[model samples]
Target: MTIQWFPGHMTKARRQIEDKLKLIDVVIELLDARIPLSSRNPMVDEILKGKPRLVLLNKNDLADPKATAEWVQYFADQGLPAFPIDAATGTNVKEILPRVKQLWAHKIEAMLRKGINPRAIRALIVGIPNVGKSTLINQLAGKKIAATGDKPGVTKGQQWIKVGTEMDLLDTPGILWPKFEDQMVGMRLAATGAIKEELLHLDEIALFVIKYMVQHYGAGIQERFGVQDLPDDMDNIQEMVKVMEAIGRKRGCIVSGGKVDLDKTSLIIIRDLRAGKMGRISLEKPF
Candidate 1:
């Protein structure tokens, strides 16, 4: 599918971020733990060059723990400090301060050279929509410091939030790239709720989720849904139909036409999976 989605404000946002980068000591890039590489904007690598970076894989509680560990190692091998955090529940939030300190050691030394006791280090939180950027900021701030909502684009302008004694957060609105070059990347982003629902094909994305689950965590699916005799040669669409039929029976999503409403079934399955009701499943493996 040729996925075409780009908002008008993104150009302005990119320019603004480029302008703001000169004033920050470190770039704290937030990525969804479920699909880190796909969610990351390549422009960030270019714009954030020469600055220390901390890649926080947020919403890790919703992703597979094993995959999260692999991603941590992968980022570390690439010479970046990476941490898996669940911003919603504040898991592993305390570790960020020390990591930030370690990343900005040179800046700290520069402060000492100026005979100035640095009060706080400034960092920017950036990510695509619904990647838990505001959630992370609120977690680090220890309060509801940033306006957070379930939908994307809730944060419009930039806001500075005080996270701790010596750390401040620059929160920006979630921004999507100009175009998705990889089809798999687009599908993965759609599956994780990073892309707007209206722009996606629900049934196709649902099938993708089913296929991913069957490949990576089929046992989990069988255990959760109590489907003992799953077809071995079934494709993703067929597996999705099985899941939809089961869910339709469970939720009584039957129409007057005596057929399962695939649309409603798809919505139910996707919502449950995204909310971690199905189980913790990660879509991508660490490189």
Candidate 2:
């Protein structure tokens, strides 16, 4: 399936972030804990080049704890300080201030040499849409400094939120790359609600989620839906049908003819899974 999604504003946002990079000492980049590799914007590396970086695996509460640990290690292997955090509940947020200070030790030293006592380190919170950047900032700031919502593109412009005496956060609009080159990356984004629902095929994305879960997660579907194990030869669509039927029966999604409403059932399952109702699920393993 061809995935086409490039908003005109994203181009302007990219330019804006590049222009603002000079004003910050560090870049605190957030990636979805569930799909860190896919949710990461490739352009961030080039755009924020020469800046100290922190890779925050946001929404950790919704992801598998073991997988979250692996992702932190995977990023650390690349010489980046990564941490898993639950932005909504404020878990691990206390670590952010200290971590940012540690990551910017060189910059802090430089300021000390210049006689800037207790210099405030400026950090820009960067991430793709719906990755929980605003929520994280609010938690850090201890107030509603940035507007947040469930949908993508809630942040329209840049704003500075002072967290404490030593740290200030620049919140930027959620950005996506100009194009998604990989089909898997596109599907993962869709599955996590990063891509708008109107832009995706619900049934197709749900099937992808089901196939991945069955392969890597070991019987999550059978356990959750009380369905028999899928046949070894069963295809993704067939397995998805079984899952939909089970969910339809459980949720009472029946049509006039008493048949399970496949479309409605598919949407319900996808929504629940994305909303973390299906349990702590992670889409990719650390490489």
Candidate 3:
């Protein structure tokens, strides 16, 4: 099945962001640390042209540290200020405002040069679904100003929150593009819980993730689920199933007739990875 999610309200959210962009001085874009390239909304570039932007890699605790550093440099090389932060633990979240100020330094200085003391800075914060945008806001405010959940689409509308005396932050609903051009991108988003779980089958995405872990993180896969060995081939479904069955047997997800409960096994794998029970991993690395 081709996995995609573009609800009607997302269209409204995009228009709302576009309308507010005119009054905003800076835009903070949140991306999933595990899938930075896949989690970025393509519409942001067209709507936010000529605006100062700080790309935040949220959920850094769940991703590879080396890959996160590379991604930070990747964005920096492209002239986009990016930082890795864990919204849940407030890790490196303290540096967010300073970077925002750093990116908009020229504009902030220009206001002073003209003898015009700027008012509160208006920043539009945008991200794809379930990227910890709401949690990050709460971390910044040191209080819960926005609703948050593990599932996507928890924040249904927009609200202006006073982050500090000199800045007002606008939290918008997470908006997804109309289509996913690459199928792997869809899989990564779904596996990372950025997309709703109901939209895709956990069994299939778990297999995809297993294949990746087999090739790139074999030791992690073995250690997490207590699988004795990694699968031999990515294209061979039987070999993949063998590894999954071993994981299921280790977790006691077996039926009365001695058959492995694939659904239960897949869900355990998915939830474990999502909760970072597996070792530090990144689905894709910058080439």
Worst 10 residues of 3 by lDDT: 171-180
Best-to-worst ranking by TM-score: 3, 2, 1
**TM per model?**
0.86, 0.87, 0.89
Give the higher-TM-score candidate: 1 or 2: 2
**Tens-digit lDDT track of model 2 for 137-254:** 7798897753544348675555677878889887554355523578888888888877776677877787787777767764666667666656454374675577667768878889
For model 3, what is the alpha-carbon lDDT of residue 187? Answer: 86
Model 2 has an lDDT value of 0.78
lDDT score for residue 212 of model 2: 77
lDDT of 1 at 23: 64
For each of the candidates, give the backbone clash count.
Answer: 0, 0, 0
- Model 3, 1-287: lDDT tens digits are 22244466657767767788877888888888999999887677876777899899989999999999999999989989898989999999878778887777787799999999877777877787678777887877788663543349675555667777767787553344522568898789878887666778889989988999898888888788878767566798999999989999999999999999999999988888888888878887886
In candidate 3, the residue pairs with backbone N, CA or C atoms under 3 Å apart (3 or more residues apart, or in different chains) clash, namely none
**Model 2 lDDT, residue 229, Cα:** 59
Q: Judged by lDDT, which candidate is best? A: 3
lDDT for each candidate structure: 0.77, 0.78, 0.81
In model 2, the runs with Cα more than 4 Å from the true position are 1-8, 146-159, 171-179, 234-236
lDDT of 1 by residue, 151-189 (tens): 497756556677767887775533546235788888888
Error of 2 at 257 (Å): 2.8
